[model samples]
Target: MNSHHQIIKTSPASLFLFCLLILPLSATCNVEKTVVARCIDQERDALLKFKHHIQSDECGLMDLWGNPGTPDCCTWKGVSCSNPSGHVIGLNLSAAPYQKTCLSISVFSPSLSELKFLKYLDLSSNYFYDMEIPSSIGSLVNLIHLNLSDSGFSGDIPHQLGNLSRLTSLDLSRNDELSAQSLNWLSQLTLLRDINLSGTDLSEATDWTQSIGSLSMLEVLQMDHCQLSTPLTSSSILYANLRIVSLSINYYINSSIFQWLFNNSNYSTVKQSLEYLDLSYNSFQGPIPNEIGNLKFLAYLNLSRNSFSRTVPDAMGNMEFLKYLDLSYNSLSSTIPDEIGNLQSLMYMDLSYNSLSGSIPSTLRFSGALETMHSLSYLDLSHNRLEGFAPGDVEDSHSTSHINSSNQLEGPIPSSVGGSSPLLHLDISYNLLQGSIPSAIGDLHSIVHIDLSYNHLQGPIPSSLGGASSISYLDFSNNYLEGAIPISIANLKYLGYLDLSNNYLRGDIPCKLEITKTPYFAKFTYNNLSGSIPIKLSYLGYNAFEGNPNFHMDKFQGRCDDDKHDGNIYLGLYVSIGLGFYTGFWVFCGTLTLKNSWRHAYFRFLDRIIDKIYVVVAVYLARFRRKSQV
Candidate 1:
């Protein structure tokens, strides 16, 4: 047996040295843990005081703010603290669902200044009730993001906000009562990357453009509804880094602003850097200048709701990267340039409510013949002067979804519309379109809404339409359509709205089992339909079945016995009655089955009732026989 036992033990001096080396490290770890886990007591008390000043907490934010069990305010909702510093850095109590009662404050809370480390503070969408923006907000000099938009703060905007030298984003929009006499404060925010002052009154701020121009790092500026109708001088500087600019709804009539934005010679910076531009709902008139195409990087362009008249510039085709283009609600005339198909990345293009005339470009069609602009998903040229037939031979339009061109176009709808595209909505109402609706339209598995009313179309409603299980709204009213209403319409599980009034349709109203159980709207008035109207559809009221003399409308007379029937009252009554009968029958049977005493009592009661009925019958029989003998 070769046993080797080498037991070496540490000395007292060595153990003491090891303890000396590990104790300080353990203490440091505890110190760091305390710092990271707990928020400062001063900041927490300040937050509580702020909450106390709020007259309304309808959003229930207070419930999560000061919980006794969780003393750490950092763990509370909408509070973010810094690491190792134990200081509150962010407080976002914005976008709460409460309406006017949200976090109401009559005065700005000075306690907010105690959060010296706050870098982000958002009190947007709250109700402040026309209080002046306090200068104390500037004390939070470390703030990089501040949003007080849509909060009822009136009076002059405090210039002290400019003291936040580190601020990169500032939003003071939707406070219609707020005004700025001078934009000198804005000039001091040199590091600002985004600023939104929409709905604020800045009519007196003549130096608005000059102040904003000074910010070399400014990238996004939105000053819509700011009463900025005054024209900018040609010498006004443009931002080289500006990517997005929205100045809509100010009724700006200055063509000079356009000169400053698109002039290739003087303002080459904005011409090259601007990517998203929105100048809609303004009074800027005259033809859209060809210089707009200078911005090759522009992706979204919205020049709608303006007084701009004349043909759309062909230069628009030069912006190959344009994804969203809306020129609706203008006085634009002339045929749509075929060059629009050059935008390969275009997704949505709307030119409705204009005076544009001529046939729709083949490039915009769902037909696969010219596979131009394959990525287009939505195209709406409705309420225009366009004429001629709609595009046909649609077999490869895999992305076109919405087509609402209610113009003078007259022709048969393409039959292969349902081939590959997942069309979601189709509305060609109030047009001169003739011929029957294509049956292939029913094959669109993703179709949601379809409207083809007020046309000269004539034919029987397609039976295959019931296959569109996702369709929620269908309208074929005021048309020449005839023949029986398809019974297959009952298969639509999601059909919520149906209107086939004023048509020559003649048939029995189909009973939709599921529709009767749920809420739905249907109108079949002025039709030749002759049959007993579905009792369930009576919930839609008498007007829905009026004007059809052949229809047995007596079934709906006195149905609800009151005018309250207009609001689904009768349908609710039927459902309640059905549920009550079902529930009551099961309850009675269950009670008898579950309790032996109840079961015996029920049978005994039945026996006595039967004996009484038998005696009555015997007496009646003897009386009848005696009368016969007499």
Candidate 2:
């Protein structure tokens, strides 16, 4: 009876331990089975059907689809599936590293629409040939992103695309044959935030701007090169949330669009949100409105290749966040405002090809306590009439500087130039700058191109210039620089274009300057250089050495032998001709004197020729007289 009692107690403890382990194990198995069942069989079959329709899989990405050994379709390349449900939601076939694997589907496949839960589809940069976008794509109501850019699609965009009301981004750019006869369908998609229709024909879509403005949530609108000519109505309400707008390469005739965009009463939200505005390559005329300063968030503004005139507005300095400002290729006049120094974040400023006249502002030098505009890297003021000294203290390291053509900048080049900044390109040609070039110029070790031509710079060519090992183009032509050509110039291995012409440089051309594999362009014309030309430099043509009176061509005979031999050949021909003429004349005279029959035959032939000429002249004179009488 005591042993039975012990067994009952042990049995109860064992049963408790069994329930603790085996019951939880059974629940865990059921959970795993439920997770595996979430990957629906129907969705896997649909993905397999879609892969079979891909006419070309050059990248071999479709090999994983529908393999029974790997039953999960969620692990396929360029595909994404929802977490637990395991439904296909995204398919991206953008041609990136494997551009050769571009799809070339001749006909649009309806199998893709089978993925009912798909929200993102990208097939950009492929070779779909001349097939139209499939009308059946509208069946995907859950799609929020669709990109078919540069896919070689032709014909009209389907109106059925208006069904995708949830789409936030749509890019159909760079399909040259793509056309949109009407954009009335775009109004249905209110959730669109970005739209890029560049290189598509929208000439007939006169209400394109209005249609786009209706989407109040739109942030980016790019319609470049669309052959658009219609002007935006002054009273039209533009999208308030727009941050980027590119309308370049169009033919809108009116400048009033600017007033409508910036000066409109309803554009307060747009002015604050707009960041990038590109209106380049248009026919815009008249003064740029001062009201543009209201856009406090404007960072990039490009108005180049237009007809904007008058002074640059002083109010532009109020845009403290402006990073890139390009106003080139315009007829703008007047002085660059000192207020320009207020832009603390300005990085690139190009005001070239204008009629602006006056001295460069001292504030632009960045030398004073103002301490703004320090980020300036690229500054081009070429082809203008600005005068006075070059900004001496303007120090931006590795800056590309251009002040060439018709400027009256004078005085010596600043010694501080190479001390602070390693210049990339420094061109100050066609200016009135005088005084010797600073020897410190060699400190710009990163200098690539240097042009100080058409100036009054005098004194010895700096030997220190050879320290600039990266110099590719160096021009000091039309100056008064004298002394021997610097021997240190031979150290420039990267010198591709070297011009010291119209100067007073002397001495023999350096043999080290001769590059055989890729010959350097060298011009030393009208200089005082002497001695024999280098044999390798002879290929540069004789004009390179012309006007150098002391240069001896005969000393470099190995290279000039062909030219000398050709001259000798002409001399021999002349002598032979003269000797032949003398011999023939004497032979004829002797024959006439010794043989009377030969002389008479020659005289008879000459007489016949003279008689024919007289008869022809008489007939022409008679015809002229008869016509005059009539």
Candidate 3:
């Protein structure tokens, strides 16, 4: 009974030891199984076959596949395998790093479909020539992300792609020859979140909007330059949950497309979720719909390069989140709305190349408060017919302002321009602006380009302008600007383009002007500049110094005639020569006509000279004749 009790107690301890040992042993077996679970033999063979079709691999991307010792394809460059199953789940042979490698293949092999477990595939930025995407790719039903963008693929997008129900992102953009005959297959990919078909042909897919709209979870749809002519239907439901929709450069000529897109049943949803909407480079005409403001979440709006006529919608102020607004290259007319000043979050605003008229709204000017577009860094209202005083208090420190061309703005440039704001580029050229360039302009230490050309701006260029050390381009041409070129201008180490032509500028060019550092485009033509040009500036052509009568060009040709009295001397010499000629002609001719003896003597002298010439000619002819006889 004692032995039995002892054995039973020891049994429990022995069993515990046995359990620890067996557990370690089982773990070792599992480790061995994982080691042996390398890439499947069939899948490895498929990869090798696929590599064989690669006509060229400058990056040597396929060197590891079937390489002497490296038999496992999971260890290859762009292959990923599952941890336990060891199935190839990802193949990313994107040519982003090997820019020089032209990875061409005559045919996309069906063997790629052998990677049945593949969930991610990216062959972007590779040159596949004109090979069509194989329909066998549909065999990868587990694929969640497939990107073949800019891969040189052509032909029809296989309808079989719809089989990837789990696909979340599909990017086949920048394939100019790729086409989608029908998008009905896309209706199957209900979980797809993003689709980028930019630069593809979708003109024939008349039901694209309807088919794409059915993807209720779609977040981003980029189809720029897709040849899509069909307008969005009123029933299109694609706007829901769509954060970005880039359909620019399409063939939608009618303006009603906006009405359909913004007035749809899903407008309310789009207003809340939509962030980026690009309909630029199209033929959109008529006024921009006031309903555009309904997209409260919109951040970036680009309607440039269209024929959008009439005033910009005042309702745009409602988009409080709007940061970038570009309405350039359109025919938008009427006064810029004061509502534009309400966009406090606006950073970049471009309304150039339009017929917008009337004075610039005072609200656009800085008020030393945050209620204005205080965040605005770039403001371009160029190439318009706007007339008004220059906005005096534009206090955005880092702003670049351009209000060029045909603006009838009159008055001195706002003195606060360079003094208060850290203005970088200020171009108010090609206008009727009159007044002296404010001396305060020199305070713009950060100014890079300042163009006040082609205006009636008069008065001496402020010596303060030279204080702007960052000035690279300075154009004050075709104006009535007078006075000597400021010596301080020579301090501009970055001065690349300097034009002061067609001005009343006098005095010699600043000797300190670093001609060698001057840009090739430097022009000082058609000015009242006098005195010899500096030898350092002699290399410049005469055209640069033309119309400056007092300026000497002979010095450039190695002559130093700096005679201050040369002009008066030449004038006196010309007068004397004229008088002498007049006296000699009259005296000789009158004396010969009035005195018969003098006339007869003159005739005899002329006859004698004629006879002597005839005799000399006759003698030479006779001598030549005699020589010929000999």
Off by over 4 Å in 1: 1-45, 59-76, 96-102, 264-266, 368-370, 399-401, 513-520, 555-630
Candidate 2's C-alpha runs over 4 A off are: 1-71, 97-101, 365-370, 394-398, 403-406, 514-520, 535-543, 553-630
Write down the lDDT of every candidate, Cα atoms only.
0.82, 0.80, 0.82
Task: Report the error of model 1 at residue 438, Å.
Answer: 1.8
Q: List all candidate RMSDs to the true structure.
A: 13.0, 22.6, 18.9
User: Candidate 1 lDDT, tens digit per residue, 565-590?
Assistant: 55577789889999999999999999
Position 346, candidate 1: lDDT = 86
lDDT of 2 at 320: 91
Please provide, for model 2 over 1-630, each residue's C-alpha lDDT reduced to its tens digit, 9 standing for 90 to 100.
Answer: 795455345655564664456775655332122233245578778767766767887777777777777787777778888866788899887875575636666666687788889999998887787788898888899999999999899889998999999999999998999998888889999999999999898988887867876887899989888888677766666878889988888766358678669656668888888999988888889998898877889999999999999999999989999999999999999998988878888888889899989988765542431266666767788888888775456444435554455577787777666664446788888888888888877777888889999989999888888888788888999999999887778777788888899999888776556543345688899989898777767678787788899998656634344567899999999999999999999998999989999999999999999999999999999999999999
What does the lDDT come to for candidate 2? 0.80
- Please provide, for model 3 over 14-110, each residue's C-alpha lDDT reduced to its tens digit, 9 standing for 90 to 100: 6456546678565533312213458899899998888888888877777787888998889998999997788999999988777764467777878
Ranking by lDDT: 3, 1, 2
Query: What TM-score does candidate 1 get on C-alpha atoms?
Result: 0.78
